[model samples]
Target: MNWDTIQGNWKQFKGQAQQKWGDLTDDDLDKAEGNREELEGRIQEKYGRSKEEAKKEVDDFMSSL
Candidate 1:
């Protein structure tokens, strides 16, 4: 989904996001608040992944939903 769709559906999406990326805390999701860049950065930091890897992981997780 696009950023707008993700933002619009964040409440529902967050559960799935948590399941997919367990390292992400609720605060991280709240802080992200549908901002793709922030979410990517948090994922990268939490998972110790490169930017591309984090983006790919996020993309894969979202696509799976």
Candidate 2:
């Protein structure tokens, strides 16, 4: 999914996101607010993952839908 799709469906997808990344708080997701880069950045920061790993995880999660 693209940025737009992510943004549009954020409310629905956030639950899935939380399930995948339990360390991610609702505040983090709110701050991310559908920005793919921001989401990856937050995940990277919170989980201590590399940029590539964060991006891949987000991509995989989005694609799973």
Candidate 3:
């Protein structure tokens, strides 16, 4: 799905994201609230990933969807 669709349906997709990144807590997803950059930040913090890596991972996740 496209970013627009995912953003619009974040309530649904956040669960999928949590599954993919198990270290992320519900609070992190809640804070992201459909914002891709925020989600990337949460992943970067939780996963000890570089900003580029987090962005790439989010991009890959979007592509998979």
Candidate 4:
């Protein structure tokens, strides 16, 4: 799915995200609030991944959904 569609359906995807990245807190996802940059940032922070890596992971995850 596209970024817009992902953002629009963020709530529905949160569970999957939590499952994929168990270290991410509920507050982190809340702060993301459907924004791709915010989600990427959270993924980076929680997973200790580089910015580009986080972005790529998020992209891959969204594509899978």
Candidate 5:
């Protein structure tokens, strides 16, 4: 699904996201609140990834689901 669909169904996807990015804290997910940009920022902070890298990772994650 696309980011908008994923955002709308964040509750369903939250656990999967946590599983994918184990370093991200619960509070980080809470703050993200289904915002792709926010989640990407959190991933970048926690994983020391470049913005493009994070976006690519997120895209891959979405595709896997």
Candidate 6:
């Protein structure tokens, strides 16, 4: 699926995201609100990953979905 679909269906996907990144709080995922950049930013902040790595992680997460 595409980003738009994911964004529109964010409420449902939040649970999956939380499962995939267990360290992240519900607040963190809620803050992302299905925006890819926000999600990557939160991952970078929480995991101390490089921006490129965070983006790649999100891409992988998207693939899994």
In order, candidate lDDTs are 0.88, 0.90, 0.93, 0.88, 0.95, 0.93
Candidate 4 residue pairs in clash (backbone atoms < 3 Å): none
The alpha-carbon lDDT assigned to residue 29 of candidate 6 equals 92
lDDT of 5 by residue, 1-65 (tens): 89899899998999999999999988999999999999999999999999999999999999999
Model 1: residues with Cα > 4 Å off, grouped in runs: none
For candidate 5, give the lDDT of residue 27: 92
User: Where does candidate 3 stray beyond 4 Å?
Assistant: none
For candidate 6, report its TM-score: 0.95
User: Top TM-score: which candidate number?
Assistant: 5
Task: Provide the TM-score for each candidate, comma-separated.
Answer: 0.91, 0.90, 0.95, 0.92, 0.96, 0.95
Backbone collisions counted per model? 0, 0, 1, 0, 0, 0
Model 2: per-residue lDDT, tens digit, 1-65? Answer: 67688789899889988899999999999998888999999999999999999999988987887
Q: What C-alpha RMSD separates each model from the true structure?
A: 1.0, 1.1, 0.7, 0.8, 0.6, 0.6
- Per-residue lDDT tens digits for candidate 3, residues 2-21, read 88999999999989999999
Error of 1 at 40 (Å): 0.5
Overall local distance difference test of candidate 6: 0.93
Among these predictions, the greatest lDDT belongs to 5
Extract clashing residue pairs from model 1: none
Instruction: After superposing candidate 5 on the true structure, give the runs of residues whose Cα lies further than 4 Å from its correct spot.
Output: none
How high is the lDDT of residue 49 in model 4?
96
How far residue 3's Cα lies from its native spot in candidate 4, in Å, is 1.1
Candidate 2 to truth, TM: 0.90
Better of 4 and 5 by lDDT: 5
